[model samples]
Target: MQNDLFYQELDQFNLFSEFAEPQHYQPVPNDWFVVITDVVNSTQAIQDGRYRQVNALGVASIVAIMNSIKPLKVPYIFGGDGASVCVPSSVLQQVKQALQATVILAKQQFSLEIRAGVVPVSDIRQLGKDIRVAKFQPKDHFSQAMFDGNGLSAADSLIKQANSQYLIEPVESDSLDNNDLFEGFECRWNEIPSRSKEHIALLVQALPNEQFSSDQIYQIVLMAINGCYGDELAYHPITPKQMSLSSKVADLQNEAKIRSGFVGKLTKYKYIAKLKLLRHVGNYLMKNKVKTDATEWGGYKQRLVENTDFQKFDDMLRMVISGNEEQRVQLENKLKQLQQSGLLAYGIHSAPSALITCMVNDYNHDHVHFLDTTRGGYAMAAKQLKSQLATLKSVE
Candidate 1:
């Protein structure tokens, strides 16, 4: 009678058959692990106003070290105040070494301290399940006890006991319950803040795709900055001068590599040249010191002509090449005529936009402006007059 009743129930619903299927018992792969690393005292650091610089250095160090660990495909998620990484079981040791190196590098370069913990999982599905279960449990007792007193409430005491046990001996489990038998199993699944979930999701999505080279990854990070801060606070629209400068820097770097036996020597040279050029330009601006808008245009033009860095005055200058060929040729002719007639003065008593526009159209140039820290307006402008001279030459 009992067998007959079971059969009747099975007949009424196909759920039993579904459960009995072979696919339901398929084994889960046990070769995945997660590492969570948090930057220590990040709150104090941000309050100290060292957050941006320190965070950049820490992330750079971490990424560089992670890239060196071979055979291990790891996904690194940056969580603002910390980062998390996932790796395959086969390369667990390598991942550990990389994490250690990241900590060491961060300390050496940015004076930042980091703490990391690892957990192994049979598969991604198991990991998700375990995390969900862990999150449901309470996990912050020892910290509370330290601040309050030696004695803790029932929940706080339970958490502290779990933490102490976990610290003494690490264990991996699919499920841990808050019972008397498992008194020392504090759940830290909630250590990863909710705000960082999006970043974690992005890291997971980026995995299974081809890994990017260091330079490529750097570009990806810089591009992400625009989105990091909302559209309102993002950088202004990229100017033509900015694009041209970036391209020229890349070319110069590539050229240095080709010239030398090394593959990336040009990158170093380009950086050095950029530093030198900026210093010289800054000095010139300080020396000229245009106070009034009236004399600003003439003062800037005279400085550009006198400055050796603006070598390609006519053909391929920086600011003047944005316009068409006819406009550029006209500007060149006007500049030449002014120089010949000796009417090209060093400063303008009163500058007008029409004159500036006419000069730009004639020379086929776009002006590069820099923020004047002392003066509240855009007082410095560079007219890139030559196209081929896009690359800045090293002064020394």
Candidate 2:
């Protein structure tokens, strides 16, 4: 019966593969915009030794504000200190209103100062490339500003300058050569920190992906919580001997703040919570024999379909045991298909069974893979679609 189910999954995998060739070029819309918020004088706050209280209050405030705005359907990102949000243009005014309200609330409630900025996305493809580049070149001015400097404050000024120079002009066609865009922008901002260059790259990339039209004023915000700036630099334990005295002090302050930060508080507790949840879910699914979420199931299937790495499949077998019978059957079917597709190499089958038993017995496998397989599959699909769209750019 398992073999039959597995073969059935293999058949489905083959079907998915037939349509997988063009998974690289998904059309990302251009209506998305970014809102950058930072805390003013964060470095000074850390130096003053109020980093812990400030971060806790700041993150809590942000979370509270975000929860209030959840009805608006805007997705947001929370970086330890501050946050960046991407909102569709249709809701731009609403987002601005919410931000403004939050700023006012921060002042009244926490005595924290807040500042925010927004940038409309035009090409996501370019943005992804730019992010990659920026990640690789961290020493540049923009990177420094983002990481430690006052670049967030200056981002609006730079955007305004770019607008004056016609740098914000829309592309004449929907299709654009990402390489050309990267090179042109890089040359245009050669004097700027490589970080800024990468920032521009991300903007360009977000443009195509979000299908942005017309110039939009990017909103920037700075938030100071518990009498300290929330957006400050991350600190490393190791300090270089040649570092300046001022730099060393700054790093020490940040390290101290992190020790007492919200992340520090949540780390151990959250880790345990996740392990328990995954194990419970994994066992439930296995016993009941139903499929887990389609998004997750489809994602695992895609890895095999695309012939990509299969290590991603390891997580599902962990917490997947607790799903209903229907879910278990679905998972079993999916796994069988993977093995039949020649994707499962060594011990995937045994792993799931062992994982199920471990979950039932409450053993000590605490490793919970956090990557959402379902989301990964969608991303893969989107990339394929984007690649197809890139072809259209060449024709244009």
Candidate 3:
């Protein structure tokens, strides 16, 4: 059977406002598979000051699967502690091996447990759920994938179940030949401090009900958010002026560890040293606005900010915004009204700064920045959201 080009052939919509509209999305092909990867005990890891590691693992999952299936563009979403990707059946086994390799790499290098799984889209539909996806291009240089419908949520739930049939357990291996598997995965940027009083990492999930659809509820929430913080990009969590390359050994070593993947001391050191030098050179180029043949250093930061996935949707609305107390309060008050009205459940985690993880295949173009708050961004908000969901379930 020929692999479906559903995602590759789909048209992209430009406006973020249109993301909540149901008409913009199409159902994921039933023959394709949903691949998910998540860090176990991530909330505890974040509390232990390991959010950077958590973010890297999430991006690592995407990088590995993407590199393995090169030239075949698919839809994916990067959560702070994990990631989800939809792939054609043609590469299911290949993709699963990459995921297993990623699982091995995570445990060996980071001492982190990654739960990886694959489920057929047909199964999700069999259970009366669906995965609909759309392409969102906030900037011409980058296209962010957006997911609606409960199919992804169902996949996550299924994968997390104990002894579930879908789980992918890594074979016992001391090391994987993974130096080339995680290409283009980089995390050299220093955390971006909030331009306003605080950075809010928020998640809003609409409830299922007969009165109104999830799309209608999300549209109201988006409008309320815009009302609190104007439609301009000023409220963006990461700004060009606030962005700078990190020189920290710890930051450099995170990428080195993933790319090196349980290699000998000499190889690991070489990886770290190479990254250190790259960081130094990047600092020089960007600080002096040196334009190279590959990238326009002067405009790269602006483009990075424009392309950051600070706001996205995948069955739920996820965002990282910089706003003052007044704006935060206004937004929360509006959210409170929505919750009281039984329209949606929400959670927000406020922090001093936001974190940026990059998957850059090219310096000129082809890069997407993943955003999260420094301490327990999406993971923490998700915890709170889960509690609220329970409360709503009880009342329902």
Candidate 4:
């Protein structure tokens, strides 16, 4: 397909039904580029209680790139500690420059080192790998790119293997004017608590080709849990009680409050107050139906409740869920049953609270969040899970 037709066709591609299948996704255009960004010492920072910064940086990278390349739709994912974005070749140079600025912001503002790069999808294919993606809407205006095959992993590995010329290198800079790209990134709410005040950040992988399709095993696993834990919403961590705004005025830094000038500091204060007021209004709307110019605000809350980001899949099915110790045990036991059947590999990290990082483009619309446990963080948890899967490799 021509580039223009390809872009238009991808916007309409839809074949998967009920559950997304790995095979249904088509290869991304070879001319497009995959830009991967992650905090270099995110695991340590999360341990230092700077989990919010890690999450904010991941979302910030996305906001920066998207804002720079408006009128273009990019496919991306917020991976707890970082993000992966695939942009069309047309904005390749612009996206790289935007990401470079973000790397500088992450370091200067949050004191976090971020690694980012623009990698050509064609180069990945040249390495005998391919990029296949299916777009799925966990929520409207919050579209996620679902990956398949080995290419996504190949591109990611190349990006992180070593700093290359294509990397979005951070420049030494004292200026903080354009650092406001993270305008919507917020961590105002305190860590969400489970009813039992205990939560688990989980990573699960279907044992590759163990006499079963990976997608089949995934469905069975989810069905087993839905059977045990009740409906999907029941296991969602964002209960009405756990949802509230943090009133700390100092938390605005990760929201990308610009501070290059005295005027900027004053502007930050005003935005902080606006955020607090919006939080109160959001809390009220969550409980009570209120009419609005667009639609009822309460319905939006219901939509958020129903469209929780508790579980996600890339090459692995990963989750950060809120529940009691008992609930954790119940899910683990089922997973063990699946494991014994040579169907999957699983790892769990227990935490007291689940952290949320939000990207709020509009008050009433275009809001999405990335959720992860603060303890070991999802990146570390996923590493452990992948190691287990390698040991339990099921070619049997």
Candidate 5:
């Protein structure tokens, strides 16, 4: 498989409206493979107040893959608890190897179970599923691929199949040598507080129907959401008031996973001390007015604001928002109406803080971060909606 050939084909695609009709999507080639990565027991971890770690592990899985296949853009989507991405058949083996190490890295370094697997496009097509590609160039600095087919959703379900041979497993020994696959991956940002002092993590999927299409249902629901709370900026979960860097060693110790030996304790303290220094560095750079100051901290901070992944589509509608009590009530009221009308399935969770996860391949640019409601909010909501849909099926 000529990997460069994959990008050449991808470049021919023009930007498309995210809200366009679903059937208009272009089918992905049968030669490509879909890769899925997710955290096992993420809900329990979030309940233990480790949602930040869960979010970071989710981002780290993609960072490891992208860093290994640098200069070659692949189609990927970020789910709050995990992710789904598509890569050419040529790079299949390398992608799996990197993920094997990532599985180990997340377990050893973060005590988290990061499940991963790859399924072929041909296999999914045989199941009567499909995948389509669309490019979203949010800014010159960043671009993302939006998937709108059942193939990815199908692949995700199969990868998570119990005891499936395709799922990547932990190595027998602790010396699998992750080879720093996740180098430069950072989750140092604090949980951003809502400016409105209220937040809602939202997830929805239009129930498949012959009477109305998923796209139509989604547009109606999205319009209702925006009409009530506002667009990304008006009810943005992370505000300047919420953007603060944390030096809390408690979270850092668990993430870095300092060795248990005496030397390991010293190394742990060293990392903690380093974070303290980094905090001061952040404060100094943020306060500096001149361009030639400590660093271009001002520009980077602005970029974080610009790059927030507030809402995205991956065969489903997902969002995280900060809204006032009045706005939340209105949004939920409309959601109830939709439920009664049977156009969509929805789930929601709220918390005091909005979680942010970073993907930094380039310091100056070409990097982005994702935001989700605290504690695997989207994942939790998806589970609830699935349960409701199941009940609906049994009754029918």
Candidate 6:
């Protein structure tokens, strides 16, 4: 089994429906590890109107790990309030140290508690469930990881337990040397206004049934969403016209705010100043259609839209779509009918706008964007899904 190249070696598929198929997924190598990080009380934080901070912290975790394991490609998924990364054993220690630093950074900066954990693929297999992974490439320059089977869900359950052995606790520290940790992470763009009546964040998990396979059930759910909201181009949460860079000082200082204590105040101020200058330059370049060796500023917004993880699958179907109340209700009715027939459990949340957090290592390529709803995003939707799952368990 290849260690570092496990994910890089997988075959890539284009159709989202093919992601639901078992044949496309390969069992994760036993030597790999799945690192999970999530904010505690995230729903309350979102209710408190700190969804942007939560989203940033989640992206911070990913950036930290990716930067630590430099030159290594891994499979990962970005949940709204957290992220999950799978790395080979060779870089597990570096990943852990990065996560620990992130834990300390989140607490000191945002007053948010982040729980980090590590679960080995070998252990997931011991539970009789495997972490089967596949690569989904919607465009030539980008690809997203898709996970199937119940291994990731089982690993999540173990980590969220009261006394999870896999938990990575934070060390006591007023400041961690983390200025270099979250290198490419940024959240300077304004919240994307919904083009439709509202933007909806949806989570759906297909249940095991004797009549129809899980893949078939998910296909039904996808059809329901596309049928009601049209297709990806129609319902995608972000568009070129709706994208705007924030001119507010506070908005530009967003990263610097969380970056406090990690560096001296003077350094933080300089960083903020640099961000302001960069934003101005970016605006001018993009507006004037300037062409640089790294990126064509004019088409960057469209590329960013194309590269977003707006719709993804990681043991669950997660998406953010633009729709009206009527479309939402129609989709809900279809999901309800399917759930009543013992096909799936779903959760949905809606808000006026969608949130975006980005990681940009390069201008032309090597950049990926994350999306969520402003009000609650995936964490709240997952909470609803958990409630339905508990109820389903009670009746069974």
| Top-lDDT candidate index | 3
TM-score of model 1 relative to the true fold? 0.30
Q: Between the candidate structures 2 and 6, which one is better when assessed by lDDT?
A: 6
How many clashes in each structure? Answer: 22, 82, 0, 0, 0, 0
Flag the better candidate by lDDT, 3 or 5: 3
**lDDT by candidate, in order shown:** 0.28, 0.27, 0.88, 0.70, 0.73, 0.87
Candidate 4 residues 237-352, lDDT tens each? 77755676776776654562432211356666677778788778767876687877865676775554544456666666767776677777888899888887777888877888
* Comparison by lDDT, 2 against 5, better one: 5
Off by over 4 Å in 6: 172-177, 258-261
| Candidate 3 global lDDT | 0.88
Provide the lDDT at 101 for model 4: 79
lDDT of 2 at 179: 12
Residues 244-298 of candidate 6 have per-residue lDDT tens digits of 8876676656588555547767877887888778888989998998998889999
TM-score of 6: 0.96
- Which pairs of residues clash in candidate 4, taking residues 3 or more apart in a chain or in different chains? none
- 347, model 4: CA deviation in Å? 2.6
Each candidate structure's TM-score, on Cα atoms with residue i matched to residue i, is 0.30, 0.29, 0.96, 0.85, 0.89, 0.96
Q: Give a tens-digit lDDT track for model 1, residues 1-396.
A: 132121112211122112112232212124455455556666566556544433333343334334444323233333334444444555566556555554554454356776555555332343233211000001121000000111111112222343432111222221212011111111111011111111110110010124543223323322333234223112221221221112234223322221221223454476447644654554455356635533353244333222111101110111111222333244345444432333221110111110010001011122211111111001112112111123212211
Q: Assess the local accuracy of residue 158 in candidate 2 as a C-alpha lDDT between 0 and 100.
A: 37
The digit string of per-residue lDDT tens for model 3 on 1-396 reads 444688988889998878888788999888999998999999999999999999999999999999988978999999899999999999888798789889988888889999999999999999999999999987778898999878998999999888999999787665455666788898889988998878999999998589988878988998899999887576888778898888788987788888877576677788878877887887788789998888988778888888789989998999998998899899999999998898899998899999999988888778888999999799999998899989977976
Which ten-residue region of model 1 has the weakest summed lDDT? 141-150
Which segments of candidate 4 are over 4 A away from where they belong? 1-20, 138-142, 172-180, 256-274, 277-290, 336-343, 389-396
